[model samples]
Target: MKTKILFLLSIIVLGTTSTLKAQKLKKFGSSIEKKIGPKTIKVPYTDVVSYLGYAAPGNEDEVKDGKKFYYIYVWVPAVAPELGVRMMSPVGKAKTKNPIKSEAYTKNAKSKDYFDTYITLERSDIISADNISQDAVDSANWVILERNDDSGEMPKQPSGSSYNSLLRYKSDINDPLKALTVGLYRIGFTTYKTGEVKGTFLAEVAAPVKLPGVVMAKTIADLKAGMSK
Candidate 1:
């Protein structure tokens, strides 16, 4: 009888632990609340673009400050009052719903390897989509809008650390150099600690307004092609 009671207690403890873990993990997106007189209303993003990507061996796009970085090119079709970016690594069993998957990700989706993810949102000076070329991207004046390391709002990493990344950047209409206008942008990702960043990652770009025609790609050429379409 005592053994049966212990087994039941173990089950109850496990169920409680799982419930606590779920509570600690926040959703992938963000929301804002407005208090209208007496009632508070939650407003979620109208448009969210998600990408499922995998960073494999020798797949680093660039190296900055001695850290290897991978980039997901973004083309903003319209002006956005605010832009939110977030990244989760070792995607685990997180809810993807329907995300645009890259070839690399599809090929290695079953791999058990994952990593700690750090991310940045950067906007380039090339405002016109027609001028988004390899040379243009290389020479454009790039501004780092936001950088995030370990976000408390994301799911905890395998090491039980809140090492995911999230950032919200509001447009500065007065500052032409830092405004989030219709232009080419990119999400830069790497590891917070100086080491390899091989793993599957889920990234999302969201806007409060319904900004249509926004597109993203893993390469400049692919982004240009997506823009043309």
Candidate 2:
């Protein structure tokens, strides 16, 4: 009788575990649909044009190896032909008296610093409805801008900018989203000329609303095992 009772208890525990897992999986799926699903935006450069944007949900306040970070999605337009956008960050204050010796100082610094910057696109060959492929979209470049020391806002005039450059997401271990960190970032067109016509948009990195895809996948697997038992 005791052996039979033990067996029954084990079965009950297994069943409970499975039910909980499945519930978590469903919740994750719903969250993804709401946050990272397909989105359409009008490419700002053209008077009237549209492009699809796809992004993955990010995690909030993720702690690893004694470091804190917040992951957020950075998106790129699918139909941008000749124009490319990148992320920028402010040049840190110079610590050395000689500007040339300062690591933060650069040769390509902009003229006047604007507290609030604008991003615009220009010199485009043409605008069309040609949809960019998933592979191309996945491989597109993204920017990571550092947050201001005093505020969450990104610096208006970046001392330096990244255009058509590779980001951490490209080399993330297993997932690109893992490369995102807590900070303020800018999304704007890449231009050769410093004062060329352009527009800028600010992206604030914060806590995520849902679990990442990897976590959700593990939860679903656990749910399956529990249900099978």
Candidate 3:
């Protein structure tokens, strides 16, 4: 036991790091590299010509029983064919009520996984120390994301931004090393957006995120244990 503890500590020590801008841990077996914030905005969401989910023009009327949903949509950038209506959506989740074949659109379907398909900004401040206790993330509008030429929200979902479970701390020392504990996050998704699983989806469902040792540990474990229900 002592050996294991020491090993983890050693890894943390040699693996710890802080940058002038943001503190980040070395990609040791237990940490994620972060570029701390007060970050600049490169792509204002306005660049998104058209969005599909509830986040589009008519968000109010998109809900049912206090919920809204959005799906894959087309985005026409200012740059013409350089980028056309590229389809996008979250990946993950086996249809709760169906036996349909796997769909590539099965990409990250988590309430949080939004796609801007066009150029967007970095959605930093994802989870932080203070508001970490507030399980209101899923309903928290949208997160600015940055990939290549595109970045944007997960497109509002019909969910309350609620989910099957909520993220929580498993220990006195919140395991920043892993994802938000082991339970399913109560991400409120609008019924409309989370459509039935079909053979063909715009994008694939979301895959589990493997952010090195720390984040992947619990997620992988939960998956192995038949979580994500």
**Model 1 regions more than 4 Å off:** 1-25, 28-33, 40-42
Encode model 1's per-residue lDDT on 37-95: one tens digit a residue.
Answer: 99987667778888888997588888899999999999998998889999887766666
TM-score of each: 0.87, 0.17, 0.19
Local distance difference test scores for all models: 0.83, 0.25, 0.25
Q: Give a tens-digit lDDT track for model 2, residues 1-229.
A: 9999999999999876653432221000111112335774332222111111111113212333333332222222231122222222222221212111111112323212222222321111111213223343334444432222221222223322222111111213344332332211222322233332222112211122221211101122332232234
- Shift of residue 182 alpha carbon in model 1, Å: 0.4
Q: What's the lDDT for residue 142 in model 1?
A: 79
Distance from true location, Cα of 127 in model 1, Å: 0.9
Candidate 2 displacement at residue 58 in angstroms:
31
Better of 1 and 3 by lDDT: 1
Candidate 2 stretches greater than 4 Å from native: 1-88, 93-153, 156-229
What RMSD does model 2 have? 23.9
